[model samples]
Target: MRLSVLGAGAIGPAAAALAASRGHEAVLWSPSGRGTMGLDGRIAAEGALSGVFPLRVAQGLEEALASADAVLLAVPAYAFPALLPRIAQAMPAGLPLLIAPAASLAPLAFEALRAGLGPRAPVGALATTPLTARRLAPDRVRIPAIRAAVDVAAVPAAATPEIATLATALFGHACPAAPDVLQPALANANPIIHAALALTNATRIERGEAWPQYELMTEATCRLMSALEAERAALAAALGYVVPTLAEALHRASGVPQGRLAAMGAAIAASGRAVLGPAEMETRYVTEDVPYGLSFYLWLAAGRGVAMPRTAATVAVLEVLWGRDLRANPLLEALDAAGLPRLLREGIGR
Candidate 1:
């Protein structure tokens, strides 16, 4: 398979490298072009994925999508609005496009945009990224771990099995079909975990202290995360989706023992795979997750008449702390909550 991976950040390069390792041809493109600048058509990866692999760096979006069997958007959630149009314009029809670590109902947004462009292939999203990695350099990546399984869903819902098959083949892991796009949307745990970590450790971030994210998951911090998770679960239940609990998710992602949230955090911290926490307040931990992630959850909760005081309060406090309205998610803003449930399950015009 030939894969076109967008974004040059940690996940993009790592994914491209992983594809190459699996004997699939991969071409990588960075929207800004800077992410692939220093790489001379080869990627160096360590940890779970090791050694150097041959990689092609496309100079433009058109070049990247040309003759590709599949397209993976590895960019951040905030980049979706701007990049989706360009992607929809250039991508060849009938080519599968996937959003890794999909957030804020991005696949639906892309589906809506693609609807006006005429017939195209299925658009899908992963509940979360298949691997946890960090960019060691322009061409180097460190993959701490690869997930055992990933939740996948497609806009039309009927195309889920096909998309999941493609994902499994590409990543060499289990890709399970979700009930609907909303299931994957609600399955993302970053917002719930990051919100508690960022807010509780604001001082550490502001002071530029290097803190290990899981190590600092004190009892209070874990308690806050549990509270947020409860609210999120309630919202998911209201939508008739029973997503995994926080502990269950952590255990699956990191191979930590499934126990209390704090106990899981402790196990992850003791494991060497723990990544460092954000060093600055403006990090995506708050900016992206708050607006694109938590805000979307709140919007859905409101439509379902579900109470999310903890979730709402966290957003409110973060806004005050950052002096910015983090809930102004353009995707959510453009959506009508009353119609979203059905919209997420069925494609546009259904």
Candidate 2:
């Protein structure tokens, strides 16, 4: 398929490279005025896959999206509302559009698109990004040695089969069927982890420590993460979505030990790799995951009258640090469903 990869950042370039390697024509697009991504097309350094092939890089969103069979927005959550409507206008109505690793809230994005394009345009949201890619340098994206697995579903539920088929065709085995968007959304693990790591280590992070961030993982952090994950699972279960615990997903991603949640966490600590990035809390895992991701979940928990103390506390701390009421951030409030309170407790797609 002719694919236009919007955002040319860490995840976007990695995916474009994969598609290009598979012989598809993939174009990389970056929005204007953000300063161009590096010569390697958004990556900061060179990697094993760096400069391995020729890629078409475009700085304008519309020009790049104009004629692709599919377009994937792999930018951070913060960048979406700023750019998606422009993309929707440039894209053909029938072409499948995807938002990979859409952080926490899938429904909000669908609602945003609906508000902009009135549901005439079709789009898909991946439960998470297809690859766990990192920007190792100015001209490189270090795709994890282990191939990542992605779960995808389309809005309105009925759109899943065709989207899945097309997604699998471009992405091969990396794209798998998620139970539902809610199932995948509930499965997302970044919000708690990022909020925990960033809040707990903000001082060290602000100090610009080049030290391995992974080594900071502690029993307390992991325990808190588990608690947060459980709270989300409770909300999802009540709403008819059963997602695995954070440790379970971590186990699957990194071969967690003894196949237990605690052991899986132990494996993460033992690995001692900075699972979160060293310096920036910027993209899919952080920025996107928080407001749209964590904040949305918090709202649901509150609306459902479920206790999400850790999530609530995390949001409070992060908002204070960031100096914003994240609950009403554009990304968080983009869709503003008239009956979202109802949808959260009893999902529409499910």
Task: Write the residue-wise lDDT of candidate 2 on 1-350 in tens digits.
Answer: 78988876677777777777667888887675332356543333233244464567776766687678888888776777777667645666566778776555544454455444444444576776666677665456676423345566666556767778777777664556664565666666767776777777766666666544445556776677777787888888877677756665565456544354445555655764335544654433345567777787876666566888878888888777756666754654644445654444333333
Instruction: Write down the worst ten-residue block by lDDT for model 2.
Output: 41-50
List model 1 lDDT by residue over 96-191, tens digit each: 898987798888887777676566688888998878889989889999888888889997888899999999889886887888788888898888
The TM-score obtained by model 1 is: 0.97
Clash count per candidate: 0, 9
Question: What's each prediction's TM-score?
Answer: 0.97, 0.83
Among all candidates shown, the one with the greatest lDDT = 1
Assess each prediction's global lDDT (C-alpha) against the native: 0.86, 0.64
